[model samples]
Every structure is written in C-alpha cells, then in structure tokens.
Target: MESLKNNFATKTAILVDGGFYRRRAQAVFGDQTAEERAAELANYCMRHLNFHGESSNLYRIFYYDCAPSSKRVYHPFLKKQVDLGKSDLFEWTTLFFNELKKKRKFALRLGKLAEEQAHYTLRPQIVKKLCNGSIQFSDLQEDDFCLQIDQKGVDMKIGLDIASMAYKHQVDQIVLISGDSDFVSAAKLAQREGIDFVLDPLGAPIKPDLFEHIDGLRTCNKAYTAHTQK
Candidate 1:
C-alpha cells in the first residue's frame, strides 16, 4: 500500500504565508525572501508528494504567499554594536534578498528552529557545545516555545488553490502541510468534490481536528523527514 501510494501520488502543491515566516522569525531571520522560501518549500513538497509519481510526473508545487517577499528588510534588531538602532542583519538582508531574487536559495529562517539551524544544523559545533556544557536543555526549551500570532493572507491562498485544483481536475490527491484549524472549510469543499485530500504532518505534532474533511493520511516518512528543519 505504501509503495502504491508513493507511486500513484501526483499533482501536489504547497501553500505558505509570507507573514507566517516573518512572524516565526519574530526578529531572528531579520530579513526574509518569499521567493527563496517559496522555492525551498516547493522543493520540500515536491519530494514528499512524489512529484515523480508512478507515472513519473511529480506534482507541481504551487507556492502561494504574499508578493514581493520583502517584509523584513529594515526591521530593527540592532542593540548598539557597530551602529546605533540600525538593522545590520536587515542591511545584510538586502544582499541576501538580492541573491535570493537571483538564485532563490537565501530564504531566511522560519522561526526558532530556523534560528538555531542557521547557526547550527546537525553541526559538530552544537555537538561540542553539548559536550562542553555550552548548550543545554534551557536553550532547547527557550527555542522551542512559540508565541502564536495571526498569519493573515494564508487562508485565502489555501482556499483558492485547493478549489482551483479540484475545479481544474489537477490531481488524484491533494496534501496540505498545515494543521491550523482555519482550513477545515476548504478541506471539506475539496472532499465534497470527490478529491482525495490528504494532510501530511511533516513530522510535526498534529492538532487532531486539522483536515477534518480529508481522509487516509499517512504519517510522515520518518526516515525521509527526520532531517527536516522542524
């Protein structure tokens, strides 16, 4: 069954929120790029959704987020080091965003996981810190806490794409990456239209009620997603 599902999957898409990434940063990824982030997410979706399905036609990842991807360009994060009240990270971000615009690989961190990952992604330094008492559980606790804030504009995109795909008959199944309760309505509509709607946890703990309308969801492929940036 697993092999068949993996083989048959097709026409997948990933929808994201620009403001969500920015807020997740909450001052860490000081400067963010939508295109770069979108591209990365698209890659993630493509891999998981089996863009190259049984027919070898991998699903098209439709990135939906606010345009211009530039909401953190001049955000204030400097505490008087080299410049007084000037956002050095944001300044550096201009170059990062430019690079992302060109290559679309400089997407900033999403939030806490993003922050620590920026400095340390399965790195030896982190391992050394753990060995030398430089990093501890407190660091883990503080970084793991998220002060949930409203991410507007994402709902509309999710709604539009799910409906569009169903109306256009784009795929045999639709998988969503979010657990936010807001998408219940959209998921229901897709199921009503006879689309095989599936929700993927991506290894994140799911909130039970998400995708109430969808059915037959497979737990994330642990071996594959164990390395996802949380």
Candidate 2:
C-alpha cells in the first residue's frame, strides 16, 4: 500500500462515472489531453481528504465507461453517411482510455454501446419555423436523422463493485463521483454496512432522493484549468 499521508482513520475508495465526468470536464475545462484529464481525476478524488479537516487512506479508483461505438451512421454536421470507426472522436476516445489505463490505482470498467434506429427529432429552430408557418415539414433534410447509442452495463458494474466492496469490507468509505440516482439502492446498501458514503456530483445539482442517501455531498470546487494557474 502507498503510504497514508492523511491522518484520518478510514480507507476510502473513489468510484467515477467516466462518461459523466468527461461531459462535465469538457464543459468546464474546454479541451484537455487524456493524460491531463486522468491526472486531474486522481487529484480530484484525493482532495476529498480535506473534508471536515480529516484525511483518509486512498484505496482505489474505479472508473466506468462505454467504449466508443464503431457503427456507421448519417453525419448530421457532415451531411453524409460516415463510419464512426474512422472518426476523430473515436480516435480521441481510444487515446483517452489508453491514458486512463496508465494511472496508478485506477481500474477501468468498460460497457457496451447499443445503437438503434429511432425517430429523430428535428432541431428546435426547424420545429418552431414549421409550427409558425415560416417553413414546411418538407424543409427537413435526410441528414437530420440520427441513430441513438445507449450505454449498457456501466451502472451495473458500479453497483456490483459497491456491493462487493461493502460486503467484503474492502474499504470504510466510498466516494462516488456520479450524478445518476440509479445508485440510490447501492449507496443505501453500502451505508447500511457502516461505510461512509460520499457523493461527489462535481457541483451538479442532485435529486433529493440521492442527497438523502449519502453521508456527504462534496464536489471538486476548482475548475480544471485552475491547476495550472499557480
């Protein structure tokens, strides 16, 4: 085990929902390399030690995400049929996962993506124009169609690990970095097992049901770029 620098008496495990963090980080940090993001992730989790002026030993970090889909689809922006397998987004995601794999005490849990054809919603602007007689439905282009890709198994893996860790006594505290309320049951189970359950929503407003289940609501208050400011 790495030396426990914090003086707290608990062992803490940080579980991260990779998809949520990526979206939030992109909104806040603009754009960053995968290595930089992974480093920020570790640093963010470690900052939990400052809560209540107490410190805890870092047990591990569990990151859950789905790999990018390789399916071919109509590109709305490019206005053509495209292969996502050859897309820049796919390349970047691959690099991101590779960088995450190199972080110490970090475990990556991958899930599957299911792509299906569904009725696509027109952009709000187009819809408003049509409704107000400014445009017709015939104005909609085929490029406006989209295929939805749903993530599978990511949440299940997180919950399963929570149960496993609680039952096995792997850690005394669990810090989950997710906004999904689907974890309420799992959080309850962990809390019932005498684990200090902390939720780090990264400053996102959480549902009341989720807030009631956690022992603490903490967030990484600094922007991602703040790390470089000093």
Candidate 3:
C-alpha cells in the first residue's frame, strides 16, 4: 500500500461550467451538436499540457450544469405559447447530458433551474427606442418579449468538489473553464493546499481580481473555426 501510494504521479483535473462554455463556443465555433462540444472540451483540457510540452496524466473532467426546466411560456419568434420542456433547447440540453455520460473520464454534475413568477419586460434596445420616441408602445411586437430562468446548486457543487480535491489530494492541478468569480474563494483554498490553479476563460475578459487568484490563464484552442468546420 505504501509503495502504491508513493508511486502515484501528479495529475490534472478539468472542471467546466457547461453553460458558459456553450455560449462562448456557439459564438466562436458557430452552432454545434453536443458530441462536437464534448470533443472541444477534451481538446481544451489536453491543450493545456501540450502548450508546455508535458505528458497527459489527466485525473478527470468535471462538467456542471442544470437540467432544463419544464415550464410553459410564450414563444416570441413563433408568436405562440410553448412548453419550454418541449423546446429544441431542452432536447439539445438532454442530448448534451447523455453524451457526457458516455465519456470515460467525464463527470456530469446536474443542478436545477428555478422558474420564478413571470413578468413582462421589453428588450433593453426596444425600451431605449420607446423612450426616444423612435418607436411607440403600440408598435411593440410579440418577438420583443423574453423569458428568464435561474440556475441553482451548480456553484455549490463546484465549490464542494474543489474543496474535496484539495483536502483529499486527488489532483496536483485544477483547470477551471469558467468566467464567474463565484469560484474565487474555492480557488484560493486550492492554492493554499499547494495545488496549481489555472483558469481558461475561453477568450472572455476576466476581472482583475479573478486574475489574481489563478496561477495562469490559458485557452487550449484559439482556432475555434478550424475545429467546427471539420
């Protein structure tokens, strides 16, 4: 047992915030199916080591997200009522969930989407136009309306895993692919435990305070277009 413990090599773990990564990927790589997105994720994690000419001793990849909510709402573009649970968005989210389950080194951590009381609000640009008298209230269209859903428990699960990795010495490095600062405190704790903490903003601008908490910032693949086209 002692020899086995001593022989354990330093390993790297990747934690991704699925929603953040997906939005950025859609902008950078255009629309992609869940399988393509998963491949991109693994490519990003491996790129970290390849950049510095190191071999991969990947511990695992952790993905955190909330399942799509089952709620009915007005569809602006379609100009009709629809069930969010039955929308294409929901179906795609489920496909993404299932694809992750098939990967050997991937861990899918699910949370919940909380639907709040519905409220009517115009788009910010539309509101500005209305205020400027460029558009009248009577000119408002059904397409201008939008619905919002809040995700819960994702960050908590992420923080708990970070703490677990640090306390249990499960990994020597952590690569977090998230832009939110909610993980700053957890990142600090990991650093205090002598683990290297790296942040992959995936081309997003990060706040200065968040910059201070991480050992470095890196994006595994910058040529997002190349990956998507193939």
Candidate 4:
C-alpha cells in the first residue's frame, strides 16, 4: 500500500474560464478559427501536465462559459434592432463549443446568458475617449457598443466541481485559468482539502490579495510568456 501510494502519478484537473480565455487568447495569440482555437486549448492544457514531468496524469479539463444570447435587441446607434443570432459572435461561440466537445477528456459546462437584462453598453476605452473629448459623440461608431449580458450559473458550477473534486480526491492539483478573484473561495476550499491550487491568468494582471489563496502562479504556454514580455 505504501509503495503504491508513493509511486502513483500526480493527477491534475484543469478548469478554464472560457470567456476570460477567449478574450485573452484573441489578444495574445491573434484570431484563429474555432477548430484551431480548440486545438490550442488542448495543447495549452497539456503543458500543465509537464509540470510534474512523467508523473502527472490529466483527469479532465473543465471549461465554463455561457451560450450566446440569440435575442433581438435595439441598437441605439444603428436605429434598428439587431438579431444577435445572426451575429459573428454567436456563430463563432457555437462553433467553438462544438469543437471543444470533440476533444478527448474535455468537459464543457455551459451556463445561460441573462437575455432579459442584456443591454448595449459602450466599450470602456470608447467611453474614456468621449470623456476626454478625444472623440465626439457624432464620431461614435456602432461597433463601439457591445451587448452586455450577465452569465448565470457558471461560477456556481465551477465552485461545485472544485469542491467535488477536492472531497472525492479526484485530482492532486487544480489549475484555474482566470484573472477573476471570485474563485478565491473555491481555491481556499481546494487547498484545505490538500489539493494544490494553481492560477494561470494568461498574462492578465490579478489582484494582490489573490496571491494569498493560490498555491502557485504559472502560465504554461509560450504565447502567454511572449505576450507578457512585450
């Protein structure tokens, strides 16, 4: 029993915040097709297994995200209603999810977008430019506004899975890919249960307090490293 315990490989589980990953990936790795992005995701996760060399075995990769809202909404700038279902984001997201489903050992957890509360909001930088008088109201473009929708059940699902994995001893390590600090509580629970909780922010800056909750900080892929250096 002692030898078996000592010789066993370290099992690892990777949890990705899909929305955060997509935004960061687009910024760091440039744009790619859905199939290419899915392959990139798988390759990125494989890099984590190398942290333990030949002693690490992947248990699974959990991706949390919300399905795009297909509702029609009024575009204040365009003076018309826009069908989000026909938008590029909706199509791309659907294709991305389908690609992810085909990857081995990938578990896709989907949450719903709060369509009822969805509204168009100007992008932050655009708002800043307007405030500084660098851009006039007449110069505003339709593309400057984005649909803001809250994601329901994603964080709850992620937390529940982390707790379950920790309690069930399903994995020795839990690596979260997110820049959000909301996962601190879940990280704490995993650490208390003896799981090594790691965070990979994909070159995004995190809050200083987040350091207290994680076991280590690592960005496994070379793309993230190159982006950070720049």
* TM-score for each candidate, following the candidate numbering: 0.50, 0.82, 0.84, 0.92
Task: List clash counts for every candidate, in order.
Answer: 4, 0, 0, 0
Model 3 agreement with the true structure over 19-79: per-residue lDDT tens digits: 8988888887789887887776667666765454445478999999988866776665555
lDDT of 4 by residue, 84-159 (tens): 9999988998999999999999999999889999889999999999999999999999889988889999999999
Model 1 alpha-carbon miss at residue 7, Å: 8.2
User: Candidate 2: misplaced stretches above 4 Å?
Assistant: 1-8, 76-79, 116-147, 223-230
The TM-score that candidate 3 achieves is 0.84
Off by over 4 Å in 1: 1-9, 17-42, 51-56, 67-150, 218-230
* Model 1: per-residue Cα lDDT at residue 63: 35
Q: CA lDDT, every prediction? A: 0.48, 0.81, 0.79, 0.89
RMSD of 2: 5.4
> Which one wins by TM-score: 1 or 3?
3
Error of 4 at 128 (Å): 1.7
How does candidate 2 score on lDDT?
0.81
Better of 1 and 3 by lDDT: 3
Query: For residues 128-186, could you state the per-residue lDDT of candidate 1 as single tens digits?
Result: 77778987844553233322223345567678778988888877667665545677787
lDDT of 2 at 105: 87
Which whole-number lDDT from 0 to 100 does residue 221 have in model 2?
A: 68
